[model samples]
Target chain A: MANLPIKTVGVIGTGVIGASWTALFLAKGLQVIVADPAPGAQDKLRSYLEKEWPMMSKVGLGPGASLGNYKFVADINDHLGQVDLVQENGPERLEFKRGLFANLDAKTRDHVILASSSSGLPSSEFVTDCKKNPARVLIGHPFNPPHLVPLVEVVPHPGTGSEYVTAAMEFYRKLGKDPVLVKQEVPGFIANRLQAAVCSEAYSLISRGIISAQDLDKTMTSGVGLRWAFTGPIMTNVLGGGGNFRHMVEHLGPASKVWTEDMRKHEFDASNPQSLNELSNGVEEWVSNIDLESLEKKRDNSMLGLIQEKSKDAA
Target chain B: MANLPIKTVGVIGTGVIGASWTALFLAKGLQVIVADPAPGAQDKLRSYLEKEWPMMSKVGLGPGASLGNYKFVADINDHLGQVDLVQENGPERLEFKRGLFANLDAKTRDHVILASSSSGLPSSEFVTDCKKNPARVLIGHPFNPPHLVPLVEVVPHPGTGSEYVTAAMEFYRKLGKDPVLVKQEVPGFIANRLQAAVCSEAYSLISRGIISAQDLDKTMTSGVGLRWAFTGPIMTNVLGGGGNFRHMVEHLGPASKVWTEDMRKHEFDASNPQSLNELSNGVEEWVSNIDLESLEKKRDNSMLGLIQEKSKDAA
Candidate 1:
């Protein structure tokens, strides 16, 4: 086992999420050794890292951090010797992930902790059967780009030790991220389920002649949405009925019933596609740039400004 | 049914919400007459309007439009003479509301649409039996201070006529406010139910040793919250896990089990008045001088800056 301090973290893929993760680690002064078989992956990640690192540093995160420490390789096994942690951003294919874990088990000595960036597939399915040290295998799901969005769901299988989970949490925290531990493996985790529930209602409203998508968006952005940025849904309800969610439950229950009668299912009708297209175009115009760098920079700058301005007064 | 281009709105109470509604109406350049029994409410509202009016002008929303048309009153009936719409903001007591609706119905002969700002109870229970013109009574719920945040939930009871609902909707729309027809009444309407669901989960996390409340707040603010301000919850999910929400759904469906299992029936346990005192004190310090005037002024400056920035982009 290698005993050098973990200044460098290795990455397995160089797609949007992988590169984003690289930028985050590199920005925090961690040397990132990224290995991706895809052609020109290193060049693409380098460019993304250069732009996003500066923006992230502008917001008061971990000081003395940037993309200067990032080094990329075309071979996977070459990274196993050096990394303190290995965050795999491989294709979401079960067989492919299984193969990677199998190879990693043979190549790496018993030092590096292997974390897969999978949102859906439980860590057990991907790593348990292959690796000799499957206990180190865990899921580290980031929200889009790792640099800007700070929520990372650290999920582990039953055999996974608590020590590894603790270490993983600390690692993410050091990077100035909000790492939420998933007690058990489940689909979508915490944020996604809540999002789906909201999306389901939003889509149903449009399908049931309740309101247009733009109006639905406006209803959120202008009304409940602003307060929600400061407080979670439950806290809003607490203040909503004057510090009594029970009162809200007692009152709004009828309206929910009125809606359940017409709850739209999963089938996407013809109108939905057209509406989605219209919405997509509108979103593109608003967001403008589709690249990872621009999106990350925009999120970082705006987020910092908002936090400085509003966070001071929020409960 | 005296109808001569119903141009003005009468506000019943001049509390925070009532004042905000007046600000919104006046900002839209419509005539507004405000009445409240509370001492100094008239002066406070005027100060609020004066500060907010210029901001509205700075945002290119118009100047004289919001300022010249406001009238304050000590008696409710005085404002009812020329107003075409009435926004009720009485105390949260059902009896008090029933009594007020009775008076409002008898006081004016104008085809004025009456709407309540109740967070929970539908106008149906409050006005189903009391009004001579029962069709005029509906619910118009706004997030606090309607001037800045602009979505209004326009909910009409079964007894309420479509003409009143349509007219009320058009009125809000004409004010450049987003009005959503709830289609049917639900407890907490559309916004607070969603809020409750999120809060329940968040509170559970805090109570359960899974994470600290402050950390959760930071997580939301840093991770999900920033994206929410620009992209919103649904769009964030669409961008979060690869492409549209399908992949996220597939992965998250299982992960949701942990949340629901942990979410539990969380009662807002304010038993520890210590925490409450501390949090309140913190918010107070941050907002020691944040009266309606200051809030309006801040909103105006931001909106003005936002408009100018956007206009520059357009140019």
Candidate 2:
């Protein structure tokens, strides 16, 4: 954060997440060299970044001169020597990711930290046996849009060193993200696990006819979501149960019993690939039917204005 | 809601919730006649209104110019004949709430709806008999601040007419709230029940050394909380698992089974009141060591700004 020395960042893939990663790194005033073998990847990254940069700058997340910091290459060898960090945003296949990391570790300098933008996969799963110095390799998972949400889950593999963890956290902090260290290698880490917990309940509620998806969204947006944004669930309870969060734990033995007995678990088997076909079709349906992209765009503008209002109030 | 007459609202109690009720009604430009023999209850309600109104208006929830709609009477019989609605924010004791509802329902007009804001006890436990218009009574429960968060849980008693349910829902909708009607009486209704489910996990996390309360709050504020403010859990899952929410459910079931087994429940006993005493004292200790009133003021400002931002976004 104190006059960061990062001038350029190397991106290993140019898929959706990869392009987002490229845009994010570039937005922070760092030249981003996105290396991907996919045929139209570079052009896609270019178009996406060009379309997104102005909006990002409007939110004060990027400088208007963002395009100057972007570069796309079909080869990692072309960019590795000059960059400070290499971000891997490749396919979910372990073999592909592992091979990518191995090449990245071998090609990049010892001082450069290698980070991945994977949501669920642990760093150890793919980065193992990558180099003589696994000390510099770690997972720096960003939510969908790294430049916006301001959260990065930093997980260090067993072989990864403390210096790398510290550096990665500091690196993300420089980009205005609030990164939390994963003490151990959990399946989904902290955010997604809590997310899964809530999602389990949502699916159960929908499946049980207790509430529909839209009503559930409203229950949160109106009822619970308001508090969770500024404060977490525990603090919500603290203020909600009249300044004592433990009151729920202390008294509601019976209710707790019911929750445990009926609680649903989240799994990722993906048996009904058709369900995703249905869901993706649903997203397209939702988008075409309600003009969701416009809703998102409107929401972003509103959020940007709000963030400005908040900053001014704080001042 | 349609600029219909809100001449006098019968307020059936004058404790903390009742006082808050008085302020909220007055803020909404409603005449309220409060009934309470408890010393200083009327004065306290007035004092709270005077202090809270300016700030509330600054945050955009007050009809400040119309603040003349508040009245406190010594007798419950004073304004029953004229008021359009009766809000019973009385003691949580089943007998107390039941007796008040009976009195309010019997004495009030047939058109007026009687509502309680109890978080725990079900409406049916107290409002089963004696009211000539039983259908007019239900629970219109709110969180700590009924005026701010804008979630009203409307729960109708079994004997309550279906017509009143629609009326209550319509009323809240008019007030610009996202109100959900609990089809059948449940102990905590929807919001508190969802809250209890999450609280159980947070407590269990604390007990298991998974994270501290501070860290857990951070985990929420930085991660899950951000998405939650934008999308509900179901939609978050749909986005989380790479647009494959159902896929995550199917694949991760085995991993989730352990979570169900590991659910933690805390038990409380009233005879040994040390725990409750400890809780109260701990809060006292924490507050005494800090500028809690100023802290609350600071929180109010922050919350005000955030709510303003969200409302603007919604608009």
**Among all candidates shown, the one with the greatest TM-score:** 2
Give the runs in model 2 whose Cα sits over 4 Å from its true position: A1-4, A61-65, A240-289, A307-315, B1-6, B37-39, B59-65, B235-292, B309-315
lDDT score, candidate 2, position A168: 86
lDDT of 1 by residue, A1-315 (tens): 233345778888989889888877877778888888888877887787776666667644455565567777767686676668888899988889988887776666565677888866777887745647777778888976566666788888888778778888888877767687777665555555555455655654555445554566656655555545555444444444554444554464445443333332322232355644544444444344456445534545655565555534432
In candidate 2, which residue pairs clash?
A: A267-B248, A267-B249, A267-B251, A267-B252, A267-B253, A268-B248, A268-B251, A268-B252, A269-B250, A269-B251
Q: Per-candidate TM vs. native? A: 0.71, 0.84
CAPRI-wise, candidate 1 is incorrect
lDDT of 1 by residue, B95-196 (tens): 888888878887766377888988777887887446468788899988755665556889888778888888888877676666888877755666655554
lDDT by candidate, in order shown: 0.64, 0.67
For candidate 2, the per-residue lDDT at A137 reads 83
* Residue B84 of model 1, lDDT score: 79
Query: What CAPRI-style quality would you assign to candidate 2?
Result: acceptable
